[model samples]
Target: MVLFDRILLAVYSLFFTVVFILFSAVMLGWPVPLFLLKDIFYPGRPEIFWPLMVILILVGGRLFWSSLHKPRGRHVVLTESALGEIKVSLHAIEDLVEKVAAQINGVREVTSQLFAVPQGVGIRIKASVTPDVNVPAVSVEVQNLVKERVFEVTGLSVSNIRVTIESISAKKPRVE
Candidate 1:
């Protein structure tokens, strides 16, 4: 979404919420809110009134459009399934990479993103490793392990695995 659109949405939501609250209060016999918002409820200037009304209606419609039409995530297709075609979400594959990579001795934390390549997936991993371990060795181990495990579980080849040592964490691993 564009910055301007986001700002408009935020403004719309905030004012809408406040208006609803004021309306509810008026309904419950408190007329103070109604008097406070009287000018907005019954605008005096047609030139300002028409443009503001149009903008509000357009923003409301845009909000509805956004709620109904959300972007879908990419998935890998597995054509070799015995029963039927299978689709695996790239997000799930990314989670798999994170889990596999974080199991390595030196890795303190892991985050990953996956891309669907031809007949396979490519992974980019961001890892926080222990301050005491060899970074190069740990990165290599994470890459190999993630590749192997993804293949073992999904039966899809991993085209590439790029591991970045994002941080050398001084703290010990968290227990789960």
Candidate 2:
């Protein structure tokens, strides 16, 4: 968000916080301006009320509309030949990366994100490893696995595979 949006949200939050505290004080029998505050909302004051309502609605509508707008994912150009052009979804690559990484012995949970690069596509894999597992070994295996599988399936060159060990899970003994 831009600076104006940040300021607006901050002001909006502060306004609600003050309202909450004021209402709490009133409920506690404090000498609050309950009648005066209510008078500010009197139906006779259209001149002041309408402009404030319109401003609130406009700002609120913009925020709501922006929240609904989803960003489009990047697509990789697989091939451009005389026959035709072929492209693959970055989502597909991420799915493939997650699946391949999850199959590795040390990984407990896997998540992947993709980005476009000058050389090719970049894959970032975040994994939760099992306790007592070798991190460097598992990371290397995951990196190699993702690179090979993604290229094999999508025919897109992988610029880099960055493996992040997000967390390590507690070890559980195998029943078998």
Candidate 3:
């Protein structure tokens, strides 16, 4: 693909180079425009057609060149045989996971990071649990919640769910 793109870019560059040369020649007092509009409808002096054709060619070439070189759009292809072995957009999946995890009990704040890998989606959840909540139990609940929600929404399995506990607060302050 890269090689093909390079070849296309070279061809486009050559075409533009030719057009530029022709435009420069016209500006240098060449009577090429007379020949272009001599037989066409609305025959007139070559002066008007010369600059118009030059502008059209320049603009058209630029548009074509850019379209050929620039990235087109997101292209995702998944076959039935490889249906369970694909990775989709992680950002979208993460949004769904966060929404579901927040609804779970004892979940203070849910911050998730997701990555699209060959096997499937890899999830890393950074959740702040309430001081009174069990850290291990909450982590397990979050993992399950995220896995279920991500699968339901995206139809892809969660490869790995890593939960990190940032901090734990005391339920009550001790008095002296």
Report the number of the highest-TM-score candidate.
2
Judge candidate 3 at residue 174 and give its lDDT.
Answer: 41
Give lDDT: candidate 3, residue 114. 73
For each candidate in the order shown, give its overall lDDT on alpha carbons.
Answer: 0.83, 0.80, 0.69
lDDT of 2 by residue, 59-173 (tens): 8877676667675756777889999989877788788888899899979778899877788678888989998889999999998888888778987778888889999988543
| TM-score computed on alpha carbons, candidate 2 | 0.69
> Which sections of candidate 2 miss by over 4 Å?
1-14, 33-51, 66-74, 80-85, 171-176
Q: What's the CA error at residue 40 for candidate 2, in Å?
A: 7.1
lDDT string for model 3 (70-101, tens) is 65433232334644644455556677777887
Instruction: Report the alpha-carbon TM-score of model 3 versus the true structure.
Output: 0.46
Clashing pairs in 2: none
Q: Please say which candidate is ahead in TM-score: 1 or 2.
A: 2
Residue 109 deviation, candidate 3, in Å?
A: 1.9
lDDT by residue (tens digit), candidate 1, 72-174 = 8777786657788788888888888888887888787789988767756688999898888998888888878888999898887888888899898789766
